[model samples]
Target: MRTKLSSTIFLAILACLLWASAFVGIKIGLPYTTPLQFAGIRFFISGLIILPFCSQRRDYFRLILKNWKVVFVITLLQTFVHYSLFYTGISMVPGALGAIVVGSGPVFVAIVAHFSMPDDKMSLKKAGVILLGLTGVVLVSLERGSLSGEGKLILVGIALLILTNINSGFTNIIVAKDKDKVPPLVLSSASMIVGGLMLFLFSIPIEGLHFSAKPFEYYAALAWLSFLSAAAFSIWFTLLKRPGVKVSDLNMWKFIIPVFGAIFAWILLPDEHPDVLSIAGMIITGSSLFLLNYLNRKKIVR
Candidate 1:
């Protein structure tokens, strides 16, 4: 049991790290491609990479046709709406700011999971840890200055990022409910394919394809982002399949995203630099995850 738990924890951390780097990757790629177009390409390649891993590969289309509605709903909320807004939001918002906004994903997930999932009900201790995490996130985000009429576009992007979190929360519940029926790899890859195609089709009129894998850095970003999605989604969905696991519980790990995002952005982006407070915030954020698990474990012991 300890070994399994440790492995899961390791995978969780790896998933967080890859996801955190996505902020830098998107920033790197945005110069070469528009937001939706960028997302489409990223996921299209990602889906192709993971599609072969589905267990029932022979019955894939039949499975998809049978489960088409579920696929549509999941991809619509999880992939299409969530990421379309996310890519757009991350495009306009500064990488650090974008990371902070999306880092609030756990708060949204925990709240929804508490109400919607009986076994995942929230306790006062859980609530307090959540608040602590949010406090840390808020501290990180305060670096973003006040909004102005001239900065309305940034505000719009911020709003999209906020909505993106909510959309993600709802989809987590949906995926939790359907985890048993659908194979995780199949679900991840299929939704990615359909969702990527949607973004690709939409981008045709708004932002015509200007894809070029030229310049090694640009190609590397695209390739790495694609691998990140495939690997992270596979790891995440695999863990979500375990008995007694809760989406809210898994989501606490998301706080690590902004922490690593800050570090990676500081490393990759020339404009951003980390400070004492951001480091402090990262420490606080990391503590909150342990706090959450400790509280939950204590509850179980009782």
Candidate 2:
């Protein structure tokens, strides 16, 4: 049991870190590829890579076909809509800022899960912690600059990032409620496949399917990020489907994304640096992790 618990924690952290680094990856890769094209190609390869490992049973295929409706919804919300907003938005925003905005998704999940999931209802204490976290997010977002010129795009990007969070929250609840015969890996792979294809198709008209990059670095980034997406999605779906796990408990780890994001952005993007407000916001944001679950003392009985 101890080993299982430790492994779960490790995988959860791994998923968060992988996702956090995706901000930097997207920023680096965007100069060479269009947003949708990059995202489509990235996840398309990821889907292909992970699907085979899902299973060999024929019924698994039937299961996929059987629950195609749910799969379609998941594909739409989780992969297409979410990543469309995510990739496009992050391309315009600073990596750390994008990370901070998207990393605050747990609050959105907590609120929406209250309405959608019976097991994960909200409480006053949860609301308090959410407000605390949002306050920190506001601080970090404002630290970027005034929303006048390029800052306007930053603001729009921030809005898109928030929409991505809301989209994710809705989809997380949907996935948590799912009680089908398919494996999580199968679900992830198939959804990525269909959604990725759609995204690439959409990219054709807008970006014209053009791709250019430095010989080594472009392919290197593509492979690295594609691998991360496959691994992270598999691990995340497994964690979400695990018995006795609450969305809040799992999503709280999202806080770690910004920490990794800030660190990577500082190292990778020379123009980006965490100033006083960003640092303080991270501290407050990171501190919200402690104010949840058993640590949150509330009178309401669950």
Query: Highest lDDT: which candidate?
Result: 1
Report the C-alpha lDDT of model 1 over 1-302, residue by residue, as the tens digit. 55565577788889989998997897687787688887888888888899888878998888888888887898788778988788778667765576667878898888888888889988787777877887777666544333232366789888999999888888878777886777888888998888888988988998887855567778889999999999898788778777667788788888887777778878888988766777678777778888876765665667
In candidate 2, list every pair of residues with a backbone clash: none
Give lDDT per model, in order.
Answer: 0.80, 0.78
lDDT of 1: 0.80
| lDDT score, candidate 1, position 45 | 87
Worst ten-residue run, lDDT, model 1? 141-150
* Candidate 2 weakest ten by summed lDDT: 293-302
- Cα lDDT of model 2 by residue, 71-183, tens digit: 89999999899988987897788755775677679888888888788888877877777777666765666565453336588888989999999898888777777745558
**Number of clashing residue pairs in every model?**
0, 0
TM-score of each: 0.91, 0.85
lDDT of 1 at 61: 86
